[model samples]
Target chain A: MSDPILRLEGVHKSFGPAHIIRGVDLEVRRGERHAVIGPNGAGKSTLFHLCSGEFAPSSGRILLDGQEIGGMKPAEVNCRGLARSFQITNIFPGISVFENLRLAVMRKHGLQFTFWRRVSRLDNVTQEVEGLIERLRLGHRAHTLASQLSYSEQRSLEIGMTLASDPKVILLDEPMAGMSQEETEYTVGLIREIAEDRTLLIVEHDMSVVFSLADRISVLVYGEMIATGTPKEIRENPQVKEAYLGEEVAA
Target chain B: MKLRPFLILLAVMVLLAIPWLVSSSMLNAAIQMLIAALFAMAFSLLCGQAGMLSFGHAAYFGLGAFATVHAMNAFNGEGLLPTPLLPLAGAAVGLVSGVVAGYFSTKRTGVYFAMITLALAELLHALAPHLKGTFGGEAGISSFRMPAWGFGFGTAIEVYYLTLFWVLLAIGLLYLLMLTPLGRLALGLRENQRRLRFLGYNVHALGTLIFAISAMFSGLAGALQSLNIEAANYAELETHVSTVVLLNSFIGGVRVFLGPAIGAALMTFFGHVTSDVTRVWLLYQGIIFVLVMMFLPRGIVGELVERFSGKRPAGEGIRLSEMLPRLAGIAVAALGGVVLIELLQRVMSRDYRALAAGGQWPEITMMGLSWQPGSPLTWLVPLSALALGLALVLGVNRRAAARREATA
Candidate 1:
């Protein structure tokens, strides 16, 4: 239980002359809600990209369930029990919410090349998609297009897509970036409910939500990890207080 | 849903009765219509469903035609390949060529994908003339349909039935494909390939498969064409064939299942009828295409489907009662435009200019009417009709706008 399900070792990423993520090392333990918090331009999203196979690290190893997945394609990484959600609400916007969820779920049933059987008749995929829709509280909006979803509802849909793969390690980048206080609270509860059986590594800017939801928190500064501990330890640490957490904790 | 089934049944019955009702020459035109319709439907599978607009589909169509002809020559309805089963040769070649071409083309998306397909077809088109044995240069390869399964395979009606059967089978398979899991993924592929990638799907493989399937059916259509005509030529591989299918699919509305077929069939029927009467038929087709694009960008069937199921445009829009007059107004305007164009076409002819070289300005006969070029009423009458139609249509537009504003 204490072993890390996802570990990034000495990961360095550079585009042209500018270095984005510099020698970042982090570990997300199995079944633990871990949050990576940082000020703007702190390489927070870059770290997520590196883990989710969006970009290959210049020099490093990304281990997902004890397998190296640093330079693998996004699909292969997902197949290795790791999944990710984009910060900007990535989903099939033109299709219905049910169709979006089903597209994410049908892969698990080995229906990729399947042409004979009707997708509507797939009871298992339908049931799983329905379960996801209910769990996300989007039952009423199942028939609506994904683009028609409200801001927070789209966020939930993104998270639901991430969960559709039943991944062992889920990387969520700013799942609550743009939301009201009430919506954020609802999402916090929803994340708590879903993250009970899986490991979650979220990149969130909301300090209160981070404090309330994360079992352990890591603060990233200028493409490096400055601190990693519980919320109380992060608040009290002198080094952390002087850096990113000073003004937020005070407020 | 209940109405849809009944409508389909009625359509099928109408298709079945086509052989008995039409003349032999008209039946030949009907055979051409089915081939064009099938080609458009095959195009919809890729362009409409998968969202990959191919500009080189005729390459697959040509490949299928040539392959079928070769199979007929080699086997002659004796052994494994029968006359009825010859289209399988085309399907096999189409699938193989599709896979090869799709592998390279599906690597890119949107404009790049279209360009690659265009280039591939051009390559085949350029090479086809030189490969005499395969594409058969100049005169092209000709063959005869053999008798099999207790049918003589003689007469235009028999050929029409055979073509109709294959086309319907291909279309039915295409329609059923939409309900399948792979078909669902096609919609996903169209929606967002990046999202599908993260969902653990081999996006490239999926794209290639869809492209190949589309090509497979396109090839089947080609086979039907050559079988109907009893010949296959390198001209079938030309870029115009590709563009015609694309134009037909778009004009018919690729978004609907039967829209492209309807458009292709109607266009083909018009082509057969108009080409005999008018020299500027292609120009007329172009004008119609532009008009449809300007006012009805969704294509005819696409517009109809949206009007019925999709959200009403802006306000509730005018009811059918109000719409009838507006449609008549547009039809009147179109008639004026057509008269003006046809008159201008006749006046600009070399023969007309040569005849007027004597300065006689003699009378001309057109559209079953005699008209003197010296008469101003000829021009004024069409212009007035055009004005009246415009005024009527504009009045309806203003009324609809006023209604919407009042409701708001």
Candidate 2:
């Protein structure tokens, strides 16, 4: 690749005794949809956490567009054009869907601590929030409380919140965890629509979804990268079959 | 734009008319209510909205009051920035103190946060008396008049109007704050601090900002109180005062916007009535508190509004037929326990007055019941009554269980 937008070099992390993310090194070019897939407890989520600045690496470095972001706070990382949707739905629950999106827009517009002016009356913010709501097909539910939305609707709102920041890179953690087949298809469409301009790094458990959406796949086992290849190459790898795909297929 | 401002205007007009319709003593009482209302609202911002239960709110109130008093003295009983603007001094001092304390306190959450605030307040209480130069020691500082501001002549009625204006302004501003993004985030922080952190918002900064705003309003109240009463002392900063404000907010329904204001008004009214009618006013307050906690946890205004909004089921008001029996049972149990404990306490003392004062070898006699110090029979009635009360409670529980099972 000409110049990767994100690069992780020998990232390490541990939770007291249990070592997770032993040494994760990966790179993502601009507008590339990279997928990280592994069995449960294989540190796939932990790697995302480290990449997004939710967890500080025990050692090594994380670089965003050639600038090191290792040990930076989540807010600082967010300001640098990297944003992530949580594994669990983590949008503001009490606020209306409109307000939730407005907050993200406000942050992007550098209005986090402006207290004198009323936020609801800001025409620019309201316009942006309304536009995002229309694009996400949440215009009907704009006034509804975020908590009152259906499971799939909330997942879509989560992605919408991440998009509101106008990020260069989007990190999605299992965007279709609890969705029905229809909901999953709808979300995959939304993901594809979003991936047109943004660099995407997703951690997913569903192999079929991974194969369909990912341009490149990195397989992890026991906190280490076991293989990196195209979906067809990964499906055909004998070692990967014995280690992960075999058990998944047998189940 | 239309409804919120109209409501605010209506509230302001009603408050402005209070002094003209009531006696001076009543106006005095109203002023106290306004101050208490402001204090309770500040408490709610931290406790109800932010899920931070502070046991040291009086520290801000007292600090503001003291600062106002000192400012008044410094200005030599003249309005330094007009009497209407005097509250800002208190608010400024409060903001400084709140920020200083909030820096360390926000590092911990939940019970540890409560404990830290409590300890900090207690430390201030201890320091207030020793800082005689500024705090005026146990005597406290007193104010006279502020040279009548732009309204001319310093009268109680004028002071009342000034207080009413400030109260309405402060409450209205707080209401506006609740609709802001920062305010919404504060509520979200209460629900899940970790989620907020992941969303790339500084949870600590949000908390500190809320704390500072709460303190600023509290200080405004304290300043108004000092101007009205013409005195600020150590009593204002005591733990008991903080608890009183907290209780009032909780009793009024912390989550409701106007709940704390109504609660403060009711409490002030209760204080006036009880103080006039009986020496043991605290006992009456305690009894009312227990009753409110057991039956109306949402607070007086909260429950009334909830009912009016049709949130409660139809026909949910207290039914005389259903309530009377429960009331009778509770009355009997409470009386029995009180009598039994009193008897036991007297029996351990020798003097009747001493027992009433707190059992220094006292004796007891009331309504043909008497007990001598060190008598074994003195222990008998208390132990028996306690056992009987436990049995009655258990019997009630069993009855409830049986009813539930039958329905099931």
Which lDDT values do the candidates have, in the order given? 0.90, 0.82
Q: List native contact recovery per candidate, as a fraction of 1.
A: 0.89, 0.25
DockQ score of each predicted structure, in the order shown: 0.88, 0.45
- For model 2, residues A83-201, the per-residue Cα lDDT tens digits are 99888998888778987787678777766555677777878888999999998889899988899899888988988988888889999999889888988887888889889988999
Model 2 lDDT tens row, B9-99: 7877888898788898888888888889988988888888888999999999999998888777775566456666778889999999988
Clashes of 1: 0
Best by DockQ: 1
Stretches off by above 4 angstroms in model 2 are A134-144, A148-150, A247-251, B1-10, B75-79, B150-154, B310-408
The digit string of per-residue lDDT tens for model 1 on A1-251 reads 88999988999999888888888888889999999998899898888888887899999898988889999998998888888999988899988999999999988788898999998889999999999999889999999999999988999999999999898888889999898988888888888987999999999988888999999999898888888999899989888889888877877
What TM-score would each prediction reach against the true structure?
A: 0.97, 0.85
Model 1 misplaced regions, further than 4 Å? B75-80, B310-318, B356-360
Interface RMSD of each: 0.7, 2.0
